[model samples]
Target: MTIQVFLPSQFTAPEIFPVIRDSFGTFSEIPTEVDFEFSNLRFVRPSGIVFLSNVARYLHRSGCRVTFSGMRRETNCIRFLDDSKFFEQHIGQAICEGSSPRSTTQPLREVRHEQSHNWLRSTLIPWLSISSQVPEHDLYNVQTCISEIFNNINDHSSQDVGSIFAQWYPNERRVIISVADFGQGIPNAVRTVEGELSDPLAITRAFDNEFSSKSTPRNRGVGLFDLKQNVVGRFGGRVTVHSLGGAVEFRNVDGSVNTSTYNVNGYCPGTLIDIELSTDRIEITNGERESFTWI
Candidate 1:
């Protein structure tokens, strides 16, 4: 049987969860074909972009014949999708033709485990240089945090490729970066080592500085911990992780750590990390810096 899903006009985080739940339900029924309708989609945030791409990737991987239709031209929605290569990644290149001229206003790209280093050095750093006005020294911290996230996907997840979307809001002086992977999520990964654990507890433990699921001699579990410290503790931003059926959000506001976690209606099936950094708060003072090198 064929299932037709209509996307919302304004696709943003928290609000788009309903669509995601419904889509997952439809796909779980093992539909012969899935058609995504984008006729009314006028605006989409970075989170929505990642969510949509991840969903498409998931559906495609699940042996469903997926097709996209009803994408209206002469709209910011179509332009954003075109520039981000969303159609090419999710649907196909043929459908992307005459969609719209690629928008240069934001930097959004996909990252693969094999090319993580190159992506960091070439795409991410250069984009930060122009968009955030972040100094060279401070760039190391950003690189370290993001690199850890990528490494986690490589080391922990079953999937190798993931989507990354970033946008800088000049008026707000903040940059939002979103990364997503369609893989075995945090809860299942942690359960392998720590025995049975709830999704929320597993996500919380995954961020602990002493938690590592690897059996190697040097398996210091500081990736997520250090990411939280750099993005939230130091930069005074927000870091959110959505894995499986649970979601956790961390924010450092007024020098205080604020965190919240809740359960979603349906499982995410993978992981999604959303980070927001305040450009005005990031101090680029001259000081001793750690070697900004990575494999």
Candidate 2:
């Protein structure tokens, strides 16, 4: 039998997790076909777009005959998805026929480890410089934080592939970047060492400066901590991570670090990290720079 799924109008994390769980939960019996209805989708954040892409990629890889319908081409949301290469990469020509050809100039793209350094150095940094005029020094720190995130994926995620979606909103002077992986979720990985811990606590432990799943001497588990410092502390951006059935968010609002965590009804399969950076709030420092090291 075919399964029909309808997407919600606002597709952001935590709030959209139930929708995603319900949609993917229908595949328990291995339906012959899955039809995704996108008619009502009008707003999507970077995390939402990444979540959609992740679902589509998972369905495609599972040998399901998937079809997308009700996506109005005139809607800016559709245009954003199209420009992000979502349709091209996931639905391909089968459903995008007669639609505007996918634009090659979009900011969102999948990032692989081999190409990550160059993508950050050549593409991301230059774009941030031109679009936001972020100071070169601050950009370096941002690059370091991003590189550590990529390293965390490579070293800990066990999945070699991940998707990154980024967009710069000039009006808000903010940039949102989302990185996702479909490997073992963070809680499961951390459980390998921490014994039996709740998913929410495991996620919280992940931000600790000395927590590492690996037992090696060189593994300091400083990536997520340093990432929080750069993104939330320095840039005054927000970092949200959803893994397994727990979600954690770190934000700097009104000169205070606000952290909130709660449980979700379903698992995210792997991990999703969303970072929102506002250009006007970036803090430039004159402190000494440490040599970049991979974790």
Candidate 3:
């Protein structure tokens, strides 16, 4: 039997999570075809685009014939998604004929653990440098902040790959970035370390500096805490995380870091870290590259 999945009006998180759970959660391997209908999709965010790409990548690979339906009705959304390389990377063809000139975003990409650093240095940073006018040297801290996410995914995830996308909103002086993996969600990973806990509490506590899942008591979850601290506490940005059934948001208001959590509609398979960073508030480095020591 083929599953009829309706892409929502707003292709963003929280809203999309429920659809994901209902549509694909029960399958050990997707046993039927999927029609990812985009008929009503209007506005799409960075994470939302990656979610679409992620679904296409995972479902197609599972031998589930996926069809990206109903595009002509929403020309603008389809064009923007096409410019972001969503169709190209997923369906292996461009849905829209031409790219948008106002498309100030990187194409959605799936990067494995091994190629992450190079993708950061070669593609992401350079894009940011040109768009934000922050010298590549000055953006090292930004690079470091995102690298921590990669480390966390690499350490915690069963899959070596993760989907990533970023956008620069010139008028708002904001940069939105998202990375996610379809491995075990954050709450599931945390449950392995700390006994049984509610999904909301699991995600909230996962930000603690001392909390870890490793036998050696090293920090992948805490590294995320540091990422939150650096992004919000230092750079005055915001982070929203959706792992399984919980949603946690870290926002910087008037130089203060505020955190809030909520229960999502349904299970969001893995961990998605979505960041809204401010280009105006970011601190630039001295153009000297700083090497990291994992040990």
Pairs with backbone N, CA or C atoms under 3 Å apart (clashes), candidate 1: none
Please name the candidate that would achieve the greatest TM-score relative to the true structure. Answer: 3
Candidate 1 lands at a TM-score of 0.88
Which structure is stronger by TM-score: 2 or 3? 3
lDDT of 3 by residue, 26-119 (tens): 3465846888888888888988887667766777778888887888733778888888878778767776665533447877888987889889
Ranking by TM-score: 3, 1, 2
Residue 80, candidate 2: C-alpha displacement in angstroms: 1.7
Candidate 2 vs candidate 3: the lDDT winner is 3
Off by over 4 Å in 2: 26-30, 93-106, 217-221, 253-256, 283-295
Give the better candidate number (1 or 3) by lDDT.
3
Q: Write the per-residue lDDT of candidate 2 for residues 86-145, one digit (tens) a residue.
A: 777775542333544322223456787778878888887777777777666668877877
lDDT of 1 at 70: 89
Off by over 4 Å in 3: 26-29, 100-103, 217-222, 288-294
Error of 1 at 234 (Å): 0.4
Ten-residue segment with the worst summed lDDT in candidate 1?
Answer: 99-108
Taken over the whole model, the C-alpha lDDT of each candidate is 0.76, 0.75, 0.80
